[model samples]
Target: MKRLNILVTGGAGYLGSMISTKLIEIGHNVTVIDILEFNKTSLSHLFVKKGFKFIKADVRNKKLLKNLVKKKDIIIPLAALVGAPLCDKHPKKTKEINFDTIRYILSIIKPSQKMIYPNTNSGYGIGKKNNFCDEKSPLNPISLYGKTKVDAEKIILKHKNSVVFRLATVFGYSFRMRTDLLVNFLVNKAVVDGEIKLFEPHFRRNYIHVLDVANAFIFAIKNFSRMKGNIYNVGLSTANLTKLELAKLIKKYVSGTKIRIIKNRKDPDKRDYFVSNKKIEKLGFRPSVSIEDGIKELNYIYSNFNFKKNKNNY
Candidate 1:
């Protein structure tokens, strides 16, 4: 593979930290720009690498972003207010970073430069009960987070050089470990509290490992010509289980953990849908880590590390 110059916005984030490291390992010259909203040390190891560079700047800074965008052959925009709750907390910042930043990037990048965007599968809000939502599935984003990503995706697709991956609920430990993610959160609850209260246990969703999500980006980079101008669902084919199923899986790993289902209550996150990875699977990209592996990984981290006292956001 030819060595390429890659720009990763929000490169210190949970997904960005992993993806940027992987890119540099493959001999790509990676320049990461992030405001370090979560943790500054996430990309500290990358600083010593010859081809890796880190710039502390907000993606919303148009002047700096334009200059940075012009130099990169491939751009991965991971900057965003990630979850529903976080987006709801700061709706204005969410719009500026999630949707507006993307719009700005599209306006400046040359047609020859490749852009691989990570969009959440939550946009497939309340998919048909028995059916799997594919790339062509109609997006009905319920939250501001999902709506912005979906809207960004619409414009991104218009650029023929762009490739979008509708990623499933991502799990697994990163340099910037996110305990808030579903599988990670449940596992943390089980390990720390020894109990989990489930609301909307029957609600179904898909999942993928953080490393696999990073690999999918690498896959798109290597096969950009073949995969460009398209949308692919990236996830683990064997792991589109329901909330209760996921909790039970965690219990299997974390022994003595009690699972309680609460009646007459609802989960604020109403994203319920099974996703199909057939589209990306056909392209020969397979996720290596299982949900079981992610659970075990998180269990090890939470059990040993006291994230509560740590200054870096876990």
Candidate 2:
């Protein structure tokens, strides 16, 4: 693999931190720009690495972003308000960061510079029976977060040297462990409290590990000419599962843990559906980590984690 200058925005977050780590490991010059919305503790692992540079900034800062984006090989835009509930709580900020930041970055970048934009399968909204969403599937986003992703995808697609990946719900441990994502949340509850809660237990969705998400970025970067101006759904085909089925997997990991179902507390997020990774698969991309392995890793971390002592760690 060639060592390229890789610029990752939101590189301090769950997936961003992991992706930055991977790039550095591969001998690339890695630059991470983040507002540290969750704080900078999660990114401490990168501080000591020689090839990695950290910028405590936001993408909306055009002066800073323009200067930083100069001569970069690939720019991955992953900073966002995240899920439906979070986006609903702060609609304006969500739109600004998720939609506006992307447009701003694209405006400043050179046409020769390649980019791998990360979108979400949640943009698929819903699905029909026996039907799975592929790259060509219609986008009908139901949440502010999903809508913002759609907006980003449109802007990136117009660029001749960009690839759009509509990602599935990411699981597994990153340098920063996030409990907000479904698989990690359930695994945490089951291991710590011996119980997990489910709402709309039968609603279906796809999943991928954080490590694989990072690999997809690398694969697209290396194969940029072939992948340019195309959209790929990046995830395992057989990894789609409902809330109930995922609970069972967690239970299998933490023996004797019970699952409790809660009804009517809130309606499900409209971003429910299965996705196909065929496009990226054709480009020789495959997920190496299984959900079972991810569950085991999360179980170990959560079991020994002390909230009081570690609250200030990350």
Candidate 3:
């Protein structure tokens, strides 16, 4: 793989921060642009690295983006109004960041520049039994967040040198601990309070480690010729597990953890579907971290860092 100038939008977020660090470690010059609306400390560790550059700005700024994009060889767009509840809280802002930001970047990204987009499996909306959704699956998004992902995907897929990653629910620890994410929240609760509250425990979904998701971006960027203009579901087939199943896995590591099943309940950010990850696997891309392993790792990270008890105090 050629040494390249990689630009990561939302680089301060969980997936982006880890991915940027990996790229820097591999001797790539990485520029991270983030709005810092949610948290600033996620990028704190990268501030002093010579190969890493942090730009505190929104992706919606067209002029700023146009000026910065000239030096970039590849762009990974991860900036968005991330979750359903957050999108619901700020609908217009979500649409602008999630959709319009793509429009702005697409206008500036050189025709020769390559790019990778991190989409969500939640965009699969719902799936039929015995029919795991692959890239060919119809997207029937159930939330504003999912809808925005679908919209951005349509705009990006038209590009000749772009790779779209419909990623599964990401687990594992980062500088940022988002309690809203399924696995992380469960692990945090189980480890800290010794119990996890459940809603729609039967809802099924796939999981992937944050490091693996970051590695997939690196893989896609390195193998861009073979991966270009393709949509790959980024995860492991074995990582697909239900909420109850996930809780049980956490219980194995965290002792004396109690589980409460809430009947007739639903999550505000509801999404349930088993995704097939055959395409990326065909490209020799396989996830190395398992959910059980992620739980153990996250428990260790939380024990040392304790992001939950010190939530937002950073």
Deviation from truth (RMSD, Å), model 2: 2.4
Regions more than 4 Å wrong, model 1: 125-131, 309-314
Could you estimate the TM-score for every candidate?
A: 0.96, 0.93, 0.94
Error of 2 at 173 (Å): 0.9
Residue pairs in clash, model 1: none
lDDT of predicted model 3: 0.84
Deviation from native of the Cα of residue 253 in model 1, angstroms = 1.0
Could you tell me the lDDT of residue 47 within candidate 1? 89
Best candidate (score: lDDT) = 1
Give per-residue lDDT, candidate 2, residue 124: 73
Model 2 TM: 0.93
Q: Which candidate do you rate higher for lDDT, 2 or 3?
A: 3
Candidate models: Cα lDDT each: 0.90, 0.83, 0.84
lDDT string for model 1 (1-314, tens) is 78899999999999999999999899999999999988779999888898998999889999999999999999999999888888988899999999999999999999999999999888675656655699988778788888999999999999899999999999999998787888988998999999998888998899999999999999999888999999999999999899999999999999999999988897665768888889889989989998899999999999999777543222
Write the residue-wise lDDT of candidate 2 on 229-312 in tens digits: 999998878788888898998899899999888988654456467777787887788899888898898899888874323221
User: How does model 1 score by TM-score?
Assistant: 0.96
Steric clashes per prediction = 0, 0, 0
Candidate 2 weakest lDDT stretch, 10 residues: 305-314
Model 2 ranges with Cα > 4 A deviation: 125-131, 265-267, 307-314
Which predicted model would earn the best TM-score? 1
